[model samples]
Target: MKKLLAFIFLISSFAQAQYTINGTMAPILESDWVILYKIEGASQKYVQDSKIKINTIDVQGKKQKIGTFSFTLPKDTEAGSYRVTYKLENAGYVDFIFNKENLNFGFHPDYPEQTVTFSISKENILYRKYLEKISNAQQQLDSIQITALQNPSLDLKSAYQTSLNKVNSIQNEYLTNSKDMYVAPFIKANSRNNPSEILDNPQTYMSNIIDTFFYDVDFTNKTLLNSSFLIDKITDYIFYINYSDDPNTQQILFKNSVDKVIYKFKNIPYKKSIIEFLIDQFETTMNLELIDYLFENHYYKLPKTIQDQKYITSKRALFATGIGRVAPDFSWIENGKNFKLSTLNDSEKYVLVFWSTTCSHCLNEVPKLHSFLKENKAVEVIAFALEDDEFGWKNYKTNLPNWHHVLGLKKWQNKIARTYNINATPTYFILDKDKKIIAKPESLEDVKTFINKQ
Candidate 1:
């Protein structure tokens, strides 16, 4: 464990952040002071306070005075998406200092007057905005509902629907016309009344857009889809997306790619639905055994939530994907061109190192790895950096010795991380001549030991 900690530490430039919290609301006679610092792309921390804030409420809920504290983001702080997160000792809620705009794109709320507009370049970003809009809009409707207690004439849903209608108009105009697949689904989902419809009936609504309907998702269609349509459409979509490959808009089509299908699909029917589908399909369809496909076969899809999602221990047993298990296939661009990885022929084995400059461990391990490769001139080490940071990774590239250096991926949570299950830093997996897993977690000692044994 100490070695593992040391090894992971090699990836760090040892940067840290500091902040000061100050304010007052009430007295804190019993609760302990808790100062927390949260960043976007990196981990958050709790530390001693040198900042200020309204005195937290005590156990007895008495009035208190205000005070302040301070902290800092170290000079070595890595350049990445981040934010300041905090919470008072007595308060139950956590406060976010960084604006939501970072996670979302074009998330404007009523810019100038009575109307608000939203536009997003990516599907994921659009989804966040869509969810946010729905939530906030509902809040407004809920507020109006308060009047219903007295007059019984207030229609809160009608009030909220009005706001959604305007949003729907914007979605209809942009989504259908755009080639972006997210546009269509997003507009379609928003045009419906509630997220429940999206969760319950993905198939029928999706199928109509593809087959029968002309794919119009404007305010014209107010009726939400039923459960039956959703299930059928989703199943068909799962298979359809699996087979079809759109070249013109190649990357964009991955918006709903069924590749990483999850258990959240069960959010609708956790109990009876999983079994019902199997029985119903078996009775109707030909040549099929009744079986729970996800849990029985592809159970990796069942994650309770994003952060604690059990794609690891619960996802069955996935090998480290070191050598065999088939190569972690990838294609990238380099030198103002394309066909980087694809150019490699499958006839021989290859050593691909997905790394980053900020990852200090890569600095130490890679050079030595390259030295070993140099001795075996026949072998190849494609050091494709997961980080595309020009200033960040480029500096490390200069000090490194001669070897193949590949780029393109800028995010740590890129395709490679997902494929390799790269939880820790400075990981080395070796492949045999046939691109089979020969060794993994090939520490410096492991490589030295293996090579000597060979």
Candidate 2:
């Protein structure tokens, strides 16, 4: 009986505490049978929270869906930990966002009128350290946002979530440390510096940053020698972005500014009690909303990656073709006109080697490369040649006997070599069917072995 009661209690504890979000209908959204988007991390595709029938639903009250949505303490959300994403595939035939549905331009808000703000002492080592952490954290978070911002989708949401978790953890730590009035400035500092690195200590670092950042584009002004100027500078980025012309530039600027602001307010002096106010008002309201925007940007950049996917394939094809990625694409261009990058990829199994005719290491690997090609018939060997003159290439090609071969964009200065950071003689990268890099700089045998297994 006791176990049963405990289990029941546990289940009840997991039940979501419900609340309603009231958004005034924009009239247009009211009539169309609307579907709510829990947009997928990394793109535009969204998952319909199948449980809910309508996006603008009436549980106890009427509400309208906003232009974009991110998961939060939704009114009906359950209490247990969830990895829910905002996505856009309603089984199949549905699109989450469309002017096809007819929505207006993305909303941009004006800056709120400035008024009272707090400052923390820079002299306190603990306070300085606490502030430094916040600043550092803000930078890490912002970088991730900027990286993700080239596109906005479910994957981006996941990445944003990772950053947000760190921020939340830091804020929670700050809340735990808030007994010290000294660190209270940090709580306010982070919230105040949203979308930018916190450059100032609450009491210092402000004046120079303002005099320099606001007016001069060079950003060559003196840094906060003292804590006071730092605090003020941190505040500037938060307040500034609402006024910037380009939204993309705005994201980077704000991140840089906020990192500086957190520098002065957090670290050792960080406290939990002081953090509650900031988390409630600052992090939750401003910074997080800004993160959502950046994630949308991240989603947009993925297609660029997708579009470029076709161009880069062979070790040489990828680097020479100008399809440079963290790891170049999986590719090949052999069998004369019949062979192309896409065709090689269709088989999903291949070893790509980028080498030069003049490369001694490449010369040594030739017979071994042929042996691998012979042994692993299922796996194709794509050998890219970096031959300055066609004569050396032809000679090297004739000598290479059987593995695939092709001349690169500029021989030694080939695009593939530069892109893959291959200043050396020979470079190798193995790829999976999904076009992800499995290994690089490995031996020809290692690459062949991998392809055979695949």
Candidate 3:
């Protein structure tokens, strides 16, 4: 039993392997704090232990931060790409492989992209030089293109084309040389052939790129998953490359791409992050409909941890708040008369507003709504103030005496607010005469536009 216990201890120690990162930076200020971020799935999480100070070290009369910045990776850490960054401007971030090996490096704050010197691995050094070459080529091409545009001469146009070809050639050569390195995939993903057949037919080109972008990429590779390179590439491919005016088609493409990636990920953290990323993208673009598809499949299948459950609930509520649904009925007392939302002036179109007195946006918008309602007799305002006390609502309500003003004294947790899934202040729902939600407007402008159309 004792021997077995000792063996287990040895295995635990092996899993807790430590890696040391020794590096230096010149032209760095002591006030600047260096941060290290570990890429997890689609996100970059800051490593608290990996932060190092930019202390000064003097070499002859000149000074450098070399040897002053060093951090040891925590034991049993996942092998992936780690990034080093500084708070100072133009001191661009650097990423390195953390495959259970110690790293030795030096860089200058002035020319981080061009001047990174790796002492331990020839792989990283070559990658840095390749990056510098690509960067310089791009810069030259940009200059040539600008000159061509300004002059519009045949000679200048020819020069621009030549420079662009040279950049592409250099990129292809670098990728060929660095075939097996971790950075190879990144370089390949980023380098695009100049003015190709894709430019002539953008839609077909974008669709082809979207289909084949991940062909060479190993989506299940933990190292690749942890690197921002893959996620960044995926983002650009989905958003920039696959630019479509038809939102229905765009949503389908986005969902298909996300589904493919998520299907490849068995790792819980990676899967969860990818799912969350898609959800955020949908929410940001106001494509709330796609969120229902996500929740119906990938979201519910994830481990029902507290965070996951919270996210699922939030998204579910958002999906439910879409148009054509019957507005949740609630009773409110105003002027000692009991009023149910569905029964309140069923003859006229109603605007249900979930607002707060303390919210500055509501303060500005509510008065505007009041004035607009007074002019337009076709619609009435049902303003539900999500406030803890009645004093603010009472004061604000006095001016807008014609509207059906109700005090949701429980604030955000008020039954009506929760039923409607009101997360933000000044939320508005345009209800038909029967109290069915017809439109969810973003602002007073949207409300005005909808009413004007009617």
Candidate 4:
């Protein structure tokens, strides 16, 4: 009898342990649905929606449908931030923190003036108030700043300074009081220019700012993984620190940013997230060599849990066709004419363009590029369309008749695109007469700049 009772108690405790979220969407139609999104793999995507049901709930001591909308987190769900969005006309979404607690939110879909309201969750309730206070304070500060800038009087300047001081005070007070809350570190990370610090040394203000930016941030805090606030804070910290105009200086600054972030993130998952983000950003640039550097220095040093063999292989592939490396040549067959890349273009330089007719960006960039290259006889365009069919290319070929147009049989998995690692449409690579990659311009403007430099 004792054993059976203990077993029953354990089962009940496990069953009762779960997070519950209650929401009210006013002016909601019968067919309208609400979506729940949780952060997955360093980003958020649609998970599932609440089903429409006619139900009753206690609303101000009365039963109603408006109060009946509720959803429960999965039993296996981890504690984190979740976003609730109602797909009603002109209605946005609301975010709240959940950690095995019952939380409630009230919002209106059509009315912008009706701000989101929360109950039962102390952290979310404080976050909403903090947002409102910041919004109101910013509007007042803007008015004062405009007046002071337009009319530079001693009194106006003093008032502007006073307003800034008050804003900093409010932020500091919140930081002290809400230290345990999820939003506290975010507020501290964003707070800037206290009166004492500003008055002491203006020259070293930026250095001070960088040192204290992530002072309170707990890299291992799983709660932060549920929201984009942490990611945005990381991005701002890296990009805004030690900005420079000189390309060499800028490159060093960027490299340092990655190294600093890797050193700070003690948690394996968080470290992996940041490393992947940095790798992705570098992959878009001609500076893909940075990815190789990171892989060798930081990524390889990480524990095996984060640095799997497949991930290492993928990173190596990105570095294969980096800047200063010879552009890989491929076969092009069009109208029974087989030609290698080197044989097609006899100009001093060649512009290899990988585009698809179906892509909207290609539609705009291709024509602009064709018009831009009309007078430049020194550079020839070897355009390859990665298309499933030649119909779209044939129709669009009239506008671009000057270049050597080749239709790739496979759309994304084309043999040439695979060789060159062309993941995005309208990718441009500027090569010399020897087929050596000189520049891989990001956009049409970049292409023009590279051409002028040449």
The backbone clash count of each candidate, in order, is 40, 101, 1, 0
Residue-level lDDT of model 3, residues 1-454, one tens digit each, is: 9999999999888656776777677766443457778877677788843445556666798665542477777767766778888655654677787666677887776676567789876557676777778888978875665454455443665566678788988888988987876667666756644443112233544455566766666666655677887777767766776666897888787777667767877778777887788888877866666777777778778877724777667766766667876787889777788889878764468888889889999889988988877878889888889999988778878888778888887888887788788889899999998888899999999998998899
- Model 1 weakest lDDT span, ten residues long: 104-113
Q: How would you order the candidates by TM-score, starting with the best?
A: 3, 4, 2, 1
- For residues 1-454, what per-residue lDDT tens digits would candidate 2 score against the true structure? 9999999988776544323221122222222222344222111223233222234444458664433222223335321111122223322112111111111122111111111111221223344455667667767766665555444432555555676677767766765666444334434434422323322232233443343443322122112111223333434446553335776776665555544433333322221111222223343434543443333332223335332232223222423322222344434445555555444554455556777778788888866777656755465666777777768777657766656676685776776566665666567766555444555635767665666566
Please identify which of the two predictions, 1 or 4, would achieve the higher TM-score against the true structure.
4
Residue by residue across 1-454, what tens digits does model 1's lDDT show? 9998987776563432322222222322233343544432112344334333344434557544533333444443332222222234323322222212222111111121122122322433454455566556555543443344344554455554565565555555545554434234434544433322121233543443344322332212212121122343445544454334654343333233322333224342232343334333433432121122333443333334432234333222244362345556566565565544545653244566666777788777878877776767555666777775666766777665655566646456766666676665566665666566576655767765765565
Model 3 C-alpha lDDT versus the unseen true structure: 0.74
Query: Which residue pairs collide in model 3, if any?
Result: 24-66
Candidate lDDT scores, in order, read 0.44, 0.44, 0.74, 0.73
Cα deviation of 238 in candidate 4 (Å)?
Answer: 2.0
Q: Please give the range of 10 consecutive residues that has the lowest summed lDDT in model 2.
A: 108-117
lDDT of 4 by residue, 1-454 (tens): 9999999999898767766777776545554567888875366677667764555667689766652367776667765667776655554667666655678877765552355788878777777777677657756765665554455443555665777777866776777878876667556555544334222233454566666767766666666655766776777876766578998888888888777778887777767777878787777775766777777787788887667787776666556567777777677766687878766557999898999989999999999999999999999998999999989888898889778888887888887677777899999998888888888899999999999887
- Give me candidate 3's TM-score against the actual structure: 0.63
- Candidates in order, TM-scores: namely 0.31, 0.33, 0.63, 0.59
